[model samples]
Target: MIYADDSGHPASGLVLYGWIEFSPDHWAPVLKSWLDLRKRLWRDYGIPVTQELHATQFVNGRGRISQRIPPRFIHRGVEYWKDFGREVAVQCLETLRSTEGLTVGAVWRRRSPAELAQTKSEAYSALIRRFEDELAEADSLALVFMDGDGSDSSYRKSHRSLKLAQRRVIEDAIHLDSRSSQLIQMADLVAWCANSSVDRHPGNHFASEWYSTFLAERDPCRSPREI
Candidate 1:
């Protein structure tokens, strides 16, 4: 199974779509590890286990989404919280690295300010094609679960239009709300970090090397494939 998510704007230097692949045999342990991490995050950081870990918001200290910041911080002090948020994001990425039985993959396409509106659609389509090729080479089949509650016609069209002789991707992506799906949240983190490695957000101090720092070991490809 695959859990996917996307990050970056078409007008940005690159638009990224990425996924974490897991086999049936390792699914149980993968879920177990994430749940365990959530439990620890809640116990140690006052972060609610049920909270959706949106990487960008969480890193920049925007949402105050944590159920409560630990009392020691003196009313969630701005400078302190800002730095703490980066710590939490790093820890989350570390969890992804320590967990086994998952492989990360992403495809990104660069677009300039004048690019068409469909740039992201084209990049996502490229990702689907890569997934199909990987599955075919392995002689396996897989299902894609992406972060969203509503249907995406563009993604649906990508799968429907695949040119492979034997389509190994089951169908159009099975959409899931990231709020309720731990794996999709992880995918969100993966895509966000991967994009940051390529295009540093002005305010994101940790963006420059996070993909290389935390996720490189788990991702044999080491970096996103630029299409």
Candidate 2:
């Protein structure tokens, strides 16, 4: 199965859409580790388990995390937590690496004015092509779970087209809330690291190093393909 997510603004430098796949044997153990991490985050760090670990939110110290810090230390604390979140994400990716049947695939496109004026077809195309390539290489059928609630008509339309074309490789593209899956959250981190690496964002201290971790475990569709 594959859990997918996207990072970066379409109007910005580069938008990355990617997925991480796990074989049946490795899925359960990785999931258990993720679940255990979630529990520890709640118990040790006092982060609520339900607060989704989106890379941007954690890095920027927005959302529920703001409530957890004192105003005087908010600025410095956010920076620390941002690094901490990066560490957590790195650990999550490493956990996936410790298993077999794990694959990471992504597609990225630099957004132009014209592309931004329309739908995010390029982003969808990047993910679809990489996913198809991986499935063909593995010669296995799988289902895709993407981060969304099926609310975006444009995305739905693109997904339909992609699915129709690659029915032999993919079983379905199911829209889901990103908050609900740890695997999807890891995909979010991968995309986030890709974006930070491309843009050289100031807050991206760990992205460069973490990228090597990605390469170490990346599958056949190894690196993020440029569109």
Candidate 3:
């Protein structure tokens, strides 16, 4: 099932992560149509990148709404950020929807920790629990995608505890039927794109908090190469 999430961090406050879900078979066409419209909006308005087009700035003259992205954009954005996860949900959804035989399901993530003692791994466990609770009805395949910590030494060190927590959660969850469950690290792909600025405008800023928390959750002891 397709799942997505976003992160946000404003100043000194704790990091926040948001998530949402979609039924891929049911929503794929709708999402594709919406993305087509987004592309056209960019083409029509000369907006080269998704990030440059702010949700508030997109307008629909036919609908007579000002400062509102088209209904589809609004709908998808709202769905993706149902719990404040961040923009990565959008990216993740877009990527997964492109494949066949995939369906999206409930999305979730831990937002912030009141104490530094709460590791990133622990926060991830909370996220997984939320997902499990939400999707208890179906025994469908589940794939979790998280943006990894960036390539900064200090940030990596800061995230050590969180990383350990994530590892623990994976270990705990691994006992489930291996054929039905899989966990992947999409951080490398994310990091490569972000660092290279391939899609800089649509970079992780839309879900900055998720990105920051990812940084804060790094396995401090692991090298960037290892991550």
Candidate 4:
């Protein structure tokens, strides 16, 4: 299975997370659709693929120097982002709805008073439990990814637990001579890409989010160079 997730620190709002899942066969078309939208956006704006653009700047701060654009631009941009996400989500859902040869799951965590009160590790532990439950009944190969806030040192503290969970989930697969599951931390790449925002080619928010889930599900076996 293929999994993707996104993370965001909403201005004056909660930290948020979202994820989607799909099987190998469904990956091509869905990825194509997402790419198509990106291409259209680039073409319309004469944006270059090698560069990126920040969402805030794309709307020109809504006619203000430092403030966000007016509601019209904000609304349009948000709608575009949401529509891009929904299209991929719907495709994934369609493939997994029957659960015939594949099972998929996604989760979202929004920071709340209770969550903030807990230690960062504690909050991550809770999120891990939800992830574990999602794949508990699966018999096929499993892959998991998660988007993380690179700034949260406390969150990274949960890496130990995440590692243990990965081992447990794929132990059976290993015993049967199958590939073991893997986990990855994709925040660095996401952060780099986000910071690289150029003109017109808005930041790849979907890729940033997907990196998390991808890192979470990759095989653990790797060489030092690979890391």
- In candidate 2, the residue pairs with backbone N, CA or C atoms under 3 Å apart (3 or more residues apart, or in different chains) clash, namely none
Model 3, residue 221: C-alpha shift (Å): 37
lDDT per residue for candidate 1 within 19-41, as digits (tens), equals 78899899999989889989988
Taken over the whole model, the C-alpha lDDT of each candidate is 0.81, 0.64, 0.32, 0.34
Task: Answer with 2 or 4, whichever has the higher TM-score.
Answer: 2
lDDT of 3 at 124: 46
- Residue range with the least summed lDDT across 10 consecutive positions in model 4: 174-183
Off by over 4 Å in 2: 66-80, 117-119, 162-166, 169-172, 219-222
- For candidate 4, the TM-score is 0.41
Using all chains and alpha carbons, the TM-scores for the candidates as numbered come to 0.92, 0.77, 0.36, 0.41
Tens digits of per-residue lDDT for model 3, 1-227: 33232222222223233322345464555445445644653554333333322221121112211233334435544522222122323443344335333322221223334542343434444555554544454544344434333322322333333444333222222122211212221222223222212122343344333322332223121111111
Per-residue alpha-carbon lDDT of model 2 for 1-227, expressed as tens digits? 87878776555745667667777678887677777777766765666767788877775445444324333344644535554555556655666566456677666677575566343565675566655775778776677778888766665555466646555445446877788777788777767766665556556655755655654357464556676
lDDT: worst 10-residue window of model 1? 71-80
Report the error of model 3 at residue 117, Å.
8.0
- Model 2 alpha-carbon miss at residue 154, Å: 3.6
Q: After best superposition, candidate 4 residue 90: deviation in angstroms?
A: 15
